[model samples]
Target: MLTGIVEIVPGVSLLKGRLSSHETTQMLQAEGLAESDLIPGKYEGILLLKAGAEVHFQDYNQEVLRALTAPNVAANTAASGQHAEGCTLRRPRYFAGDWTGLPCLLEKEGLLATYDVILSAETVYNLDSQRHLLKCIKQGLRPKVGQAWIAAKSYYFGVGGGTASFIQLVDRDGTFEVKAVDVIDDGASNKREILLLSFKA
Candidate 1:
């Protein structure tokens, strides 16, 4: 039974499926394939398949050869039992030069419920500002989460150091401590990296 979205087709991710044997038979019947059209090939009985279910999924295609000897004769190496969401993937990248360009992204994604990323003297949970952080992320403001998420430039730091480091994010969502968007040698000092994001108070 196909419960969710995303079913992998031979070429691309298919957006349909998960019908049962009777359902497939009905569909085929509607398509003009009769009960007699379903003959004994390899599968023992008639062919009854589902919509979202796949070729070897339930093995009721009614193509006898498929039902009876398909399994032992054929081998499918594709990942099984996994549902794909296809084009339903989420886009998580946004940017803007100032705070004025933040709110739209937040409102569009409807993420004004929780979360925050800003600067202040008090603890985040106690702050009184809904700076609209999610908006910033939608406007192409990619935030490097975790230890650090910054936007700096390429400038030799001190003497013998790696690329210039500036931004950092501390979200403990188990994915990243930080992610770097852009790098500038002294971007932060010159206000070159001046994108700020925060949540509701």
Candidate 2:
């Protein structure tokens, strides 16, 4: 989700543009991320968060977090006659780091292989990073009961990574069962799919 300031405004388009002038892009270029959105072992397409600067996806992230933490907020409000604001909630922990090594680090911190459900969106656009991403999921996701939901296009035209390719990888790995939970074929964009990966029984 390469969001921008406009994302904070209501009714704004969620379409993303190239990061031509963003400071993060410049910094990545300086660090040798020439033109590609991703460069393995060097830069992955994450924006650097600056102190005192509002993150582009902050609002969306907060909304999602709140929904996850208080899914019954509306029901509670109607039943108890209390407003949503009165409900006390504990926030989930947020972590940011390179995807390549994050799983190993979290494992050392006793956080790996603990998640029941993992979600990833639009991450399979680059062929180079898919293996690393899969590795991270394999390491962090709980065995047997854990599952990962990946949303990606059926075919990424230029970068050569997509749901089909990813499923092939998973099949070759032989550790997970891949299933297409949903498919989106709007005719305006590339065919997209939501894939579910779970450990083999």
Candidate 3:
């Protein structure tokens, strides 16, 4: 779970551009307890990790950026003083140098062997990768009881993808049951939400 958070933050930084790494750390530090509220109460699972992963973009890839911000996530986790262990970052399981080709490459090393719960934040903005993301969920998530928690703005203005559109894809396939778990109105341009997904019963 921590690793997933680590993987996600850097991509977000690339998107915002204006927030420095230090500022990002400060924001996480400031949030403190508010951030804890986002975690599930009964989570005892490892997040599927793909180390050395890059966010492929039309212009430039953010592999180096993701690598650099990963350490900060560990620093923040250490600061939070959680007693969790077994967080190891590994090179992505790449097949023919493509991230989307396959995931969980570290499985050969026996890491993140099970993913009962998957969490992603701000990852639905890219329409191009949504299919791959969904494929990851379908392949990695534990059947029946496994769940996915996706957090994003209700609508992303320029990117043309958001929770609504992602949910539309899920609805079109009927593979999972999804619901809006929480909505936070931070007085921002768009409302933030957490959507919970589970395999259909």
TM-score top scorer? 2
Winner by lDDT between candidate 2 and candidate 1: 2
Which runs of model 2 end up more than 4 angstroms from their true locations? Answer: 1-88
User: For each candidate, what TM-score against the reference?
Assistant: 0.18, 0.61, 0.55
Q: Estimate the lDDT of model 1.
A: 0.30
Clashing residue pairs in candidate 3 are: 93-105
lDDT of each: 0.30, 0.60, 0.54
How far does residue 158 in candidate 3 sit from its true spot (Å)? 1.9
lDDT of 2 by residue, 1-201 (tens): 233322322222123323444744554555323443442222111111111111121111222323221232222223332323333322334444447867766778797888777778888877777888889889888888989999999998888999999999999989899999999999998899999999999
Q: What value does the lDDT take at residue 1 in candidate 3?
A: 19
Residue-level lDDT tens digits of model 1 in 35-67: 333432222211111122222212113343333
Deviating ranges (above 4 Å) for candidate 3? 1-69, 73-99, 104-113
Candidate 2 accuracy as lDDT: 0.60
**Model number with the top lDDT:** 2
Q: State how far residue 118 of model 2 sits from its true place (Å).
A: 0.4
Candidate numbers, best lDDT first, in rank order:
2, 3, 1
Lowest summed lDDT across 10 adjacent residues in model 2 is found at 43-52
